[model samples]
Target chain A: MSQCLHQVAGPVWNLGRLNHVAIAVPDLGKAAAFYKDVLGAQVSEAVPLPEHGVSVVFVDLGNTKVELLHPLGKDSPIAGFLQKNKAGGMHHICIEVDNIKAALMDLKNKRIRSLSDEAKIGAHGKPVVFLHPKDCGGVLVELEEA
Target chain B: MSQCLHQVAGPVWNLGRLNHVAIAVPDLGKAAAFYKDVLGAQVSEAVPLPEHGVSVVFVDLGNTKVELLHPLGKDSPIAGFLQKNKAGGMHHICIEVDNIKAALMDLKNKRIRSLSDEAKIGAHGKPVVFLHPKDCGGVLVELEEA
Candidate 1:
């Protein structure tokens, strides 16, 4: 394994609740149908996000939501993922935080890398920033201002 | 983008809550420390599961838990993962369900494959069955009898 004992004081506030689990799917319609027709899940209509270059739909689970993501444009991040993983896969996970700016400062102080320099409006219309997966044990984590 | 329109006659019972998100880590102690000391989260003692060839610790997030897994033996399933990833990564996700047998049968009926034919005792000391990653959009899924 690897070795690292970097220490920093715990979060100034609670890390926050898990907002959603995002899944990258090549075909949005087919994936939505599987959740709806097979699992009997109530899925939302697909919303296109031109800024993020992705289209998304939320699957309601009462306590949480599953965000289905699909590439929207040529330079979409999901497009590269789909090229590598032909079928699709779990993309990233989002967690809600009370203050995005504070969280970003905390992460920066801890020497953590953020994918973006600043938080951008996400699918929920909330400011969100993505943490580098390399720092998160290979799991891409998103912190949404809640 | 793949095509799938498999329809099932809805589930007889609601799928239970998402129990935990499992992450495969190279160093269990270091990973646990990150969540505890960095995130200020409560973490459980590391527990070894000889049968599964892994040692695990649960980081409590109040509403949910993050299960950190490390290789326990040479033949451990996580060993190969660590060899390739070096820094570890998100391995699988477990979802709680009302009945394991019913869920298995439902999956079988849908032509979905399970990793094992029978449920095995998981770290939570509950009967758990793994679903094939290929069938779950490249994400390994575990269904625990709740």
Candidate 2:
């Protein structure tokens, strides 16, 4: 199995397609409008993800999506980010994968850390897990089930 | 020409496929090794882009690319980013466009500001322009000719 390991190790597991690039914005409405009215992009209705502590809107890019996230509550996760950066910025990126559990197992086996203990339902309504930003060169990487 | 304007305004510019997501790294070799050895990603040989003041390597993700950028000179654009983020992080994303000039014109007409007056040859060997981060909700966006 070492040869199989070697081949898979050339590029282990499936690094699937990029699902979306998430951007955190101070004002969801204004950001969405900027893309829609100015850039002529199709902006989706804002959906509140209370569990995730953010309200999100998707700007359809035809090929991919630009997700706009805003803090939903006083203790929202994005509140700290907004506090540090008055203006919004790119938050995280989601990459599609075949199996969340398998991916997690593989990453753990490689000593890669996951932000959470287990997978959770993400904005796409799919099982997802976040990799530690430190482990991902400061970029928050999210793996979602395809 | 109002009808023509309307046609162009309906997402007139084509937002082609995402070319690559660039991540600024403190140590290019270490970052490349992390992706290659740990993540099992096939990492390309690092190439120095003297004009851009950085050394870069691409990690093929099958669907897209992850570009690792390391500062090569004192005035490298990514130097300041790394100074603030000692651990390094996602820098900017490059999206493919059909006509760089046309896309710039469209963005300019809509009041979107580009970081430069003209397109420059980017690491991908394509004409590219970076949009002002403030104008793009704080995300530095690179538009490259398809």
Candidate 3:
């Protein structure tokens, strides 16, 4: 419906600003070693987000990032993804945008459901919104304002 | 024995380069609308890779590419992925690397089974290798060269 309105459609994903794709790994250090020694990506930091129940390591890939996550407990999101997914990998892809709210509204206009109805503060205290995997084709996609 | 070498110790996947990440959709034009018209990503081309048993539209997402695949025939790869995975969508995440041969060698050295022992060319004349879901969790990852 809004596509007819063109730029009037809420906000684009700011596609060009997409930063990194996150993968859920069973062993964070192991994945870090693989991505670093093998892929040569840079590792920035590893902070345990207890509220989320996991330890995360951020690997920088220039314009994008690869987040390797290890579940802290049995009921963690990464654990659920690993059990259903198997060999532990990609959790969600994060795309960077200047305006998170506008971008979220755009996804909504496209009939895509957000994991969070509104943009919320993420790990780094940055505003973020997660698109439902149902709408993203089996991948949890996070939109963060750059 | 060489998990340190190949990295992942459990299985061997003679992955070549990332072939492309396939995104299944009920409507190609609508999906393309979100990826292209909305996100500003380009729809480079659309073609049917009958050998792989799916029709695909390549949506270029800068560093990566989003492939919108429609089932050409019933019970095709796209259809099967949809059937098993259902609503939530990551079909498979492909990784592009050098030396598929050496990669497989490292896998075998670690007693890991592969979906296939070899590589086959597909779509854009690039070689592809698939890892058995049993070994790679539920995800069917494709490996090729960058």
Candidate 4:
């Protein structure tokens, strides 16, 4: 039944690999060290994205990544999250999509609300949009163009 | 200097791929549908683990998986997390390790406390140990034997 429906109305977009799981941390250096020295994963140097209001360090896990994020400015997006979760916590999960616009449109038609009306350049310099957590089982999901 | 130190101290264990990210959900069916019907991902049937006190549905994302967990029995570990986050949320991330015992020993030596003194048989039937969230930047990290 599903296959027949798919053949008839063909899916608009395709979901790709799991990009990275974002973690918000109060201490960026300690978090980076935890992945690099403690867990012994290859970690990238902390890259400050002032415009994005966060400093990110990518912890390479071979197949995927763990992005450690820290507040970079006064009005950082993750500031309130850090305030609520004092010690910091898992922030969001980014998943790759073949077509952001198609995915957004399809998701919108499915009543899945995006945080923004259109895709924006994400930290990875790819077009991305965050789906509302309320509609995603309280999980902030980022769909990035693959 | 780090390379020289690595040669001198040789890391005890190696961190492998990220196995899966676990999300605790209040409603198993709805969460499963969100990933399957909404996001169009390959989802598995919910498997009840009475001993583990949770029902799990694997959302295969190609590279890794999203384990959607719902409280099973009365003593479900995720029951409290669900109570706190009514809409459901990301619970823990499981990362594979080359040597579980060695990883636990090394982490213990580094003052990285595990929730239990020893590794236990996890839901996937692998030896797994959960590290203290406080020590892991408030992220509950599960180290599974690869």
Candidate 5:
């Protein structure tokens, strides 16, 4: 088994709660239309993140949000993921917490690997860190401050 | 882009809402321990589905669930998924709806593909269908009726 256990999201890895799920899509307009028209999620904001080379659309899902990712530049992480996955799909699952730094330190000390090594500004400009799926059983997870 | 749009989720494609995200772990007890003690997720029940060759433990998150999958028989789909996805991880995302047949038909009309032609009894023995990720951008989705 891996040496690290990321229990910082609190006892059961529960910091606050799920914030949103990011899905990588080839077409932002089509994905937006599906969630908005069919599923009834309201579009809160759509922003082009040049730094990440992706355009993001936030679809409000009542208690939470669903982020749709479409590549803006060929070099974007989402774009890279699409190339590797060869099928646009889920990017990562995000969770909200009270304290991100504390959680990161805890995860680090416990030996759980992190993708970023430090918190970065995420959607809504919130501080977030992504934990390696190796320590988390397979699913890529992101922890952020609410 | 391809022509298919909605019908991927079975007949209804009317995925009412996000249902649950399934995670696979090497040790069910240890993993379930992490989610329950840390995440504050209440453990509902541990069910075994011989047909699927897996056992499941659900961690409730309001209306949704975090399904923990552990392979029962060596030939289980979960076992194959684990072999393909080392370190275990999020296996699939489930969506709930009002009607299963209608959802399936809806997806068919959209030309979206399905893993199962009809809804089969799932972990809770509820009617459910797994949608092929090829239809969606990349995420494997499950459609079900509540």
Candidate 6:
């Protein structure tokens, strides 16, 4: 089915590298320790993103990264997710796109819904939009402009 | 804490790249279509691994891959996971390691538990071991030999 679609017309925007995998952790310090001290990965200090309602720590794997997220304020976005997933879990995967607008337009045409109509400035200060998990095989996917 | 640990002694094994983020999907075809057609990713055909009790479709995002897994046999390891995550969800993240034996030994010394005492041949025909989710901040982690 995808072969036929690919043969007809090429993709509007190129899907680049996987930016990072976000993990919402109940204990940010413990999670950071596990990745750094235990796994021997280069881990960054927790940066509080108050506007985003979470504190993030980047676990750099040299190729890609794992973003460790923890609830920051009262309206932390990951708070509810932590409630359901007590110990912490893989929250979302962010993939880079050559053009965010083109990707969103193409996805919308294909009946793929985005969480928002327009791309917003993400943690990296890049234009990003999240796709609806229900339409994305039940996995929360974030598309960031590369 | 990690800085202090690093100052004391170097890690036993090196942590390599982020291998793949595994997603357990209820419908393999739909998930594959979403990645190949909708997202315009280079996706491989579903390969059934009866021994592994799952069918895997690799969505290549250039730098890293997203592994879509579906149960192949009755006693599939992902069966219980899919039952809980009815709409499907992120299952585990596999990270490449330079030495599996040394990594296991080091993790054991740190009181981090693996699912098994010994590493087993994984889907990629490489030595792999799954770390206990409880000890790894509730996220199932697979360490694959690079």
| Highest-lDDT candidate | 4
Error of 2 at A89 (Å): 0.8
lDDT of 1 at B99: 74
Looking at candidate 5, what is the lDDT of residue A116? 90
Candidate 4 vs 5: which has more TM-score? 4
Q: Write the per-residue lDDT of candidate 3 for residues B12-61, one digit (tens) a residue.
A: 43323333566677666666666676556778566877777777888766
Q: In order, what lDDT does every prediction score?
A: 0.78, 0.82, 0.66, 0.94, 0.73, 0.93
Local accuracy of candidate 5 as per-residue lDDT tens digits, A49-143? 88767899997655566688988866776777777766677778787777778777666666678899789997568898888876666667888
- Model 1 misplaced regions, further than 4 Å: A1-11, B1-11
lDDT of 4 by residue, A1-146 (tens): 76456444755789999999999999999999999999999999999999899999999999999999999989999999999999999999999999998898778777899999999999989999999999999899999998
For residues B37-138, could you state the per-residue lDDT of candidate 5 as single tens digits? Answer: 544458756688788888888876664667899999768888877887667777777777778888677666656678989999887779998887766656
Query: Using TM-score as the measure, which candidate wins?
Result: 4
Give the better candidate number (2 or 6) by TM-score: 6
Per-residue CA lDDT of model 2 for B1-146, tens digit only, reads 87458546644456676688888999888889878876667799999999889999988876678899999977999999999999988888788877788778778876789999899998778899999988878788898998
What DockQ do you compute for every candidate structure?
0.42, 0.49, 0.25, 0.87, 0.36, 0.84
**lDDT, residue A68, candidate 6:** 98
Q: Which pairs of residues collide in model 4? A: none
Which stretch of 10 consecutive residues in model 1 chain B shows the poorest summed lDDT? Answer: B1-10
Tell me the docking grade of candidate 4. Answer: high
- Model 1 CA RMSD to the hidden true structure, in angstroms: 5.3
Q: What's model 6's interface RMSD, roughly to a tenth of an angstrom?
A: 0.6
Predicted complex 4: DockQ: 0.87
Q: Please write out the lDDT profile of model 4 over residues B1-146, one tens digit for every residue.
A: 76456444755688999999999998899999999998999999999999899999999999999999999989899999999999999999999998998898788777899999999999999999999999999999999998
Candidate 1 docks at the CAPRI level of acceptable
Candidate 4 residue A3 Cα shift, in angstroms, is 20
Better of 2 and 3 by DockQ: 2
Candidate 1 per-residue lDDT, tens place, B1-146, comes to 12222224534545666788888898888888777765567898999988888999987765677789999977998888789878887777777778787677677777779989888888778999998877776667788887
Model 4: CA > 4 A from native: A1-11, B1-11
